[model samples]
Target: FFFSAFHCRGIRDDIEEEDEQVSDAINVSGAAPPKLCTSFAHFGFDEQLMHQIRKSEYTQPTPIQCQGVPIALSGRDMIGIAKTGSGKTAAFIWPMLVHIMDQKELEPGEGPIAVIVCPTRELCQQIHAECKRFGKAYSLRSVAVYGGGSMWEQAKALQEGAEIVVCTPGRLIDHVKKKATSLQRVTYLVFDEADRMFDMGFEYQVRSIASHVRPDRQTLLFSATFRKKIERLARDILVDPIRVVQGDIGEANEDVTQVVEILLSGSDKWAWLTRRLVEFTSAGSVLIFVTKKANSDELAANLTQEGYSLGLLHGDMDQSERNKVISDFKKKNLPILVATDVAARGLDIPSIRTVVNYDVARDIDTHTHRIGRTGRAGEKGVAYTLLTHKDTTFAGDLVRNLEGANQAVSKELMDLAMQNPWFRKSRFKGGKGKRLNIGGGGLGYKERPGLGAESSVSYQTLFLENCIISSIFLKSERKTCMMLSHCRIVASAAVCLQPVALKVTANQPPELWGIACLH
Candidate 1:
């Protein structure tokens, strides 16, 4: 599945080639009609707004924008499932802006007409910026509300009559609780990254905010994955909606090349990571994901010490610090971002070329989430995993699960690993130790060094002698023994034998051989 971007460079090239071919055809056939450029003058958009679109170099509407804009302009609920970085922000923002500008003639006491809630502060800011850019034609006011910034500043912005507010769930809920902003007059609501927000357990906050909006208002839900839970939430909030899925929801970025490298127990995983970083330094930006916050911090610090520009982000950091780290990474001042799962989700860095999992994820879900940081918006990217002995089992399980889900790891990556010198020398071998077969007749018998001819001994006496010898060995090894009345002995030895298995007659008197023999 693919999501095509209208103004993408690749798409522009294709259009250019088509235009050349069309001109050639027209020259050959004098009967061909000349192409005409239609203006948006008759669409009722403000003259200045149309001018701004032209100034922004937008010639025609993208497929998503063309389809979504009209519906949103009509104040209809929409569910848009498109590939990440498909200009989805503009698809929803343009119409919303047009509608708000159309309603700007309302009295001075009017409330906000639109509210866009994103899962992360970065995305919220991105949407906020887009809205400001598209709404430049009118005196439209917009403010971004997120936890990392000052609440007082946001309140002030709201009080000043910001017509549109793009915000994160937590910060938006705070504003609602403080009564600093009223959504009762809101006519448009957008839930961007609805699936991610639910996964982050922001359901209650989202519901509370949704409760404040007018019941009859238009609601738009957008996400990469519109699974059952997102559908359920949409059912609870949206009216009869126009559902748009541009591509397969489960389809990952095809341009991304993924590889898993299994390592020996004593190998330095950090060294392998540093080498990959060096290799990727010439390839735009890189985002490295680690499982723990402490690991992220330590790894970032170590990378910095090694003369690589890197930033760190985790849950333990305050909002201000997190914002700074993200800002630095986005500005390319920091080429690498070592982050935990919390900091990685919902981030909108478009130029990231590589995503490295410093450690194999404990589960398949986490593995998928981590690699998703790269190869966004149809850009070619790469994902790498560093696996230690302890991670082998989990990595194998994750790969198998992904295959079962029809997201197979690329065989090209496996071939690449086979050619790598490091992989050749340190690759993981098969399971250790040979399987022992106990099916032979002499399986339970330990052969003595020499056979001794002794006086006649009863069968029960011989069994008791053997039991005593086994009990002594077990006592020395800190194991347990269970006796069977059928003259069979079940003795468990440490480091070799399986757990004791015994069957005793109900009438048999069990003898207590030694205290140490009982586990």
Candidate 2:
């Protein structure tokens, strides 16, 4: 079906009947598991907690909360994978409160019972807010520690000893080193947005923090994306964990209508954006995403000079100023926000009606997160992307994702995807008397007449070099050999194939370089 945003002046209010039926099926895989809790009452939570759930107006549990909360309550490690804005925060927060409340009270000079570490400062605060929202039911204490805020104030909060501590990696390590907080007493540890944390180069800090926690403690990791590094990290820390996958990993939310428009160049983006800003912002709050921090400032300045008041958010701003900007945006004080990727990951605002990619995302995963900022909690939302030729590397992936969601793909977008080398089909056109056959093993070349063993070997080497250069986009190792003995391209058979060897060093694009030889 066509995305309605393209047909109207603003975000289309006419959502299709089929678009409303977003899939809620979840796949839970592991050893023996507890019965799935379809509703909050199934968990047999405390009466006050039940009242809080009702007061919050949560009618039913999200897919992740249905399966993941019970697993966490079973005292087993878990890796919760779901799309962003899928209520993943509440999935772990509810269980963590139960785990903390069942334990003894914190004593003087002691640490929190639960430690939740995420990648960004904004996410750290977001999780802390969630912790407070639910923890208030049990009169539980929670504190948020992150960078750019007052370190001494955070240290004071730590020294006072809260039952739950939400923080980012760097500041938490600093607190640990200063003896402001101790992880030895922590029995419940969480790595929210686990993939992003590791992606941002927090592996060493995360591993170090995990080492300080009690070995027998319960660990949990929650993220919208899962990667090889996260899998390896889970294996090292978790003890027989259950994997709760809410939906297909790396796929955009079905509730979001993605519209991609191909632009001639970067210079055309500003004009395209200016024409749509009035209609988009008039409908509801709009978030404009840029690739760099400097770009966020520049765009915000340009917009303000045009008499449009908007909020600006990036990592460079101090914590207080950033907090104020986000507060104003959340209260609907500002109708528009220009932000960098820092706001792309875990900062959730349900009122955001549309997200605009002024600068195309650097990678497929980033693109997924950028669109995820809208269409939260099954609310219909729209995302517009401005694409140029320089972003062709990820165009193929973007097109595939759109098609997977059953959204309409434009001809211009399909043409760009076809032009990408990684997705392009290879055609072999070579000299006569040489037959090329590709099989499960590798490429094979049959022999031709009037070619000696030595010359055949040289031709094979040249062919192998061509293969390496052609498939340089692949990251994995390829072991292949060619056995061709023909040349219509070269006039003289004597000098047709030369015995030249090439070796790609470690700095090359592909991680592994293959050494080819004659069979």
Among these predicted structures, which one has the highest lDDT?
Answer: 2
Worst 10 residues of 2 by lDDT: 432-441
At residue 15, candidate 2 shows an lDDT of: 21
Clashes of 2: 0
lDDT of 2 by residue, 1-519 (tens): 664535542222232111122223665555544335555655657776778888878998787777777677656678888877789888888877877776667789989889999999898988888888888899888889988888899999999889999999999999999999988768789999877787689999999998888665778988776766777787678765677766566667889999998999988998998889999988789999998988998999989988898999988889888899999999999999999999998878988999999998877678888899999988889999999987776777777667555677798887887787754442122211111110001111121222212111111111122221111111112221211121112111111121121222223443344434432
Q: Quote model 1's TM-score.
A: 0.65
Model 2 stretches astray by more than 4 angstroms? 1-24, 426-519
- Provide C-alpha RMSD values for all models, in order: 29.7, 21.0
TM-scores for all candidates? 0.65, 0.77
Q: Deviation in angstroms for 206 in model 1?
A: 1.2
